[model samples]
Structures are given as C-alpha cells and as structure tokens.
Target: MSLADSVSVTVKHKSHAADVKPPTKTTARPALTRLERAERFWGWIMVLPLLIGLAVFYFIPFVQNIFYSFTDLDQFMNWSTFDINNYLDLFSDDDFYSAVFNTLFYVVVCVPIGLAISLLLAIGLNQNIRGKALFRTLLFLPAVTMPAAVAMVWQWLFNKDFGLINYLLHFFGVSAVGWLSDPDIVRISVSIIIIWSSLALKIIILLAGLQSIPRSIYEAADIDGISTLRRFFCLTLPMMVPTLFFVSVMSFIEVLQIFDVVFLTFDRSMVESDTMTVTYLFYKNAFYLQQKGYASAITVVLFIFTMLITLVQMAIGKRLKVA
Candidate 1:
C-alpha cells in the first residue's frame, strides 16, 4: 500500500476502536456511613417516646371513649356489653338537650366578645406608654392563675348578698340579685369568669401579631395622612385576622368544654335550664351518677360538636384569608 493508503487505513482503525468503546456507566450513590444511619435512627428513637405518649394518652383514650359510647360501660363487666341504648336515651332527655344548647350559647357569646376585648386591649398596650410592662404583667396574671382559685374569688365577688359586685351595683343605685344561686344569673357569672381568664392569653397573642406587622406600613399611613381608625380598619385589622382567628378558635374550644369554674362554682341545685353546660352535664352523668355509658355518648356528641365548630371556623377563616 502507498503511505497515504496506509495512513487512511490507520485512521479507519482508530475510528473503529473509538466507536467500539462503550460509554462509562455511573456508579450508584455510596451507602450512608454506619454512624450517619445510627444518628438518624437515634433521632427517631428520641421522638418515639413522645409519639407513644400521644398514642397512649390522647389517641387511645379518644378511641376508647368512642367505643364506650356504644357500650353499657358499667363497672361490673368493664364495659364489655355493647349497646346503642345510651345514645338513644341521651337524645330523649330534655336536660341533655338544654346542656347542648347552653354549651353552644356559651361558645357563641364568649368567642367574639372575648376576642374583641382582647384585641382592643392589645392595641392599647402596644402603644408606647409608661408602665407598659407592668400593665402587661397585670393583665397576663389572670391567665396563669389557678382556675379553681379564680373561681372561689369570683364566687365571693359575685355573691348577691354583700358581694363586691352587688356593692358596686348599689353605688349605681341598682338592686342586688342572685348571681350564682339563680339559674338566670349562673350563665352570666360563668361567662364573666371565662371572659376575664381568656382575655390575657388572647391579648398576648394579638400583641405578638401586632408586633409582627411592618412598622413601615404605619409610617406610610402617617405619611398619607390616614386616620387612626381608617389605618386600623385597612391595615392593622386585616393583618391581625390570622392571629384573631387562631385565638378565637382556641377560646371557642375552651368555652365549649368549660368545666372547672362551672363544676366547682355551681351544683345540681343551681343547674338551670339555661346554665348547665354540656361539660357540666357530662361530669354529672359520668362521676356523680355513675352513668359511664351515657356520659361517654354525651362526650362523643361533644367531640362531634367541637369538630364541626372547628371546621366551620376554619372554613370561615379560609374565606377571611386568615390562614
């Protein structure tokens, strides 16, 4: 072959060799080191205690309560006898019906009014003022107070005869009336305590929300010569909606299950057609009368009530763009 032919043949051979060589395959990712895997396992192990606690205390009880609602739930058989009669009996009782109504009423009245008061107080406290920290501490103190002790103090304060409330009324030339003993007044008394205790926490939450609002917005509002009320309506209130909704939902749930003040404050004699909350009634059935099955059924109904109300509030919050 000529030199050119030989060179061309060599080039062809080089091309063929290159074409026959396959692309390199990528190796799989390296397995995690044993220590790394162990660390991950340990992290899960650390959380396992909390998960088990929640399952045992909250989830298990919730499910057991539902099961007991469908059974006789007596002490003798350890609630083995499943029956639907307890639930049927619950709906038939007028007292239970009243309790349902009262509990709903309590939730309705307390939620909005309490939230409004708290928001107003939070706004006031948010302003630069003397003794601001002291005021905040005083306001928040009620939230941390023991519920039972608060109830006792309020009982004296609200007493119809020579009570501080009655004395204050006398100063205004009003007559004293039964506060705790009277069915008509019992709800009012309970509502007062609920409102007072809840205000502090809600105020604290709103204060946090207020602090989160961009100060630039307020400065811009000032530059635009906006009125205080207008700025609040346009900017402050809208921004606070998320916080307000959260606080409202929490307060609503708390009110729905209000038992400590109502339980320790009033008795069966004071249980009015209007004053007996579902929780109070539940206590009566479960502990006082030993009707565990019926009480469980009522508890189930209450759970449904809370769930539905929460869902409704969530829907409304979504519409309000609170979430």
Candidate 2:
C-alpha cells in the first residue's frame, strides 16, 4: 500500500476497533428478601401512628396559628378581615415589651445557674459517697412531682409573714419581703423556684454524661499528674461538649417558655406586669381575653426567636466540634 493509503487504512482499523468495543456488564441490585421487606413494612407501621399524631397536633395547628396571627379572630374563630394590626399592636404594646424582658430575664438567670448547679451536683453524686442514692432520689423528687403541688409548696415557703424564707431572713434583721407581690423581688423569687425545680433532671442528665466518660482517659490523666481542675478543663469539658450543648439548648428553650410555675404559684392579682413571661402573656390573651389572633401573633414572635437562638447555638456547637 502507498503511504497515504496505509495511513487511511490504519485510521479506519482504529475507528472500527473503537466502534466494536466489548460490551460492559451492568450490575443490577438484588431484590430484597421477603423478611427484609417485612422488616421495613413493620418499621414504618410502628412509626405511622406517631407521624399521624404529630401532623394532627403540631403541624396543622402551627400552620393555622401563622394564618390566624394576621386576622382579628376571636376565641369563637370568627373574623371578618385579615390585617397586620395584631403584629403592629404587639410591637407597640408595653405589656408585650415587659413580657419579653421578663422572659429574657428568666432565660438569662435560669439557664446558666441551673447548668452550673446541675454540673456540680452531678460531679459530687458521681463520686463514691455515702447515701448518694438517697440524695439523688431526694433531688429528683421535685422533677416527678406535679407542678401544681410544687407551686403550692413554694408559695407557702415564699409567704412574707410566715414563710420559711422570710422567717429565716427575719433572723438576720431583714424586714419581711413580699416575694410574690413585690414586682422588684418576684422575678428573683420565681427564678429560685425555676432553678430548684429544673435541677433534678439536669443533674440526672449531666450525671449520665459523666458516667459515660471513659475510665481509661481519666487514668491516663492521673498518670500524667494532671490536677483535677486541669483534667476537667482540658479533658472532661471537651469530651462533654456535646452533652453540655444538648442540656444548654434544652434549658434555654424551657426557660424561655416559663408559665406553669408563675401561674400556679401566684394568684391572678399577683401576676403583675413585672412577672409576666411571654408564654403567660399568650395564655392571658388566648384564654382570659379571648383574643386568639393576638395570642397567635405573640407565639409567632416567640417561635421565630426560638428558631434563631437554636440556630445560633447549633452554629456555635459546629465551630466547637471543628475546633
């Protein structure tokens, strides 16, 4: 063959080889066995009821609440128009501002104090101490007790004239203090109850976290001659970050919605402007005043604020994990 002919023949052979490539095998996924299919079916069946309950109780009402917030809906659910007046009034209302302040105060005062006390209690209880079980049971009793009963007991304890607290204070030459009635002192009084009641569960959770820490790690720390405080800060705390983050987020959310203790502890007359939290404000509007629309608006703001706070915490937690 001539040179050009030979080149053309080679190119033709290469193109033919490329076009006639071997067939590739494609792997097909094996069909699930009958038992595997049955397992998945039962798993979904087990969760279906919970999913239905959540949709009915949480999701549907949540969407409806958002819609109602813009309307002037009454307790009877009657409304002629939808407007932004509820939100507008919410921003301008002094009571709303007061509620916000009170709620924030509870969050600020309760979360850190509760966490710290809970951590200390957990640490102490985690040690091999005498009567530790009894102590833990005593501490955890409040968590299982009814809120109404707890409130009733705390109310008596907080009584100005004859309460245990004031009686003790009187011994120190301090005059009687109106814990529930005085606006200046009521927040602190309520915070005391909140922190006390919340400590049991927090202690239990922190104790679990403490127990979960590996013994070998601590033994290594001891071998290194690390001081207790240094071990905590350098080893224990970093390991407990995830548990701490969980507890903190839960505590923040719970404190932000403080209502039952305030309501049951104080009479209606004593639930004044200074002591009213956002949840209590919502309750008063929704039930007492029959202004469901305005109540919904209040809840919407609270929901947004909660979402923002939780997001911020999660972001901070992500950074901590990365670090």
Best by TM-score: 2
For model 1, what is the alpha-carbon lDDT of residue 248? Answer: 85
Per-residue lDDT for 272 in model 2?
54
Could you report the Cα RMSD, in angstroms, for every candidate shown? Answer: 5.6, 2.2
- Angstrom error of the Cα, residue 101, model 1: value is 1.3
Measured on C-alpha atoms, candidate 1 has an lDDT of 0.87
Best-performing candidate as measured by lDDT: 2
User: Mind sharing the TM-score for model 1?
Assistant: 0.88
- State in Å the error of residue 312, model 2: 0.3
Can you write out model 1's per-residue Cα lDDT over 61-80, one digit (the tens) per residue? 99999988998876553766
Clashes of 2: 0
Pairs in clash, predicted candidate 2: none
What is the lDDT, from 0 to 100, of the residue 2 in candidate 2? Answer: 98
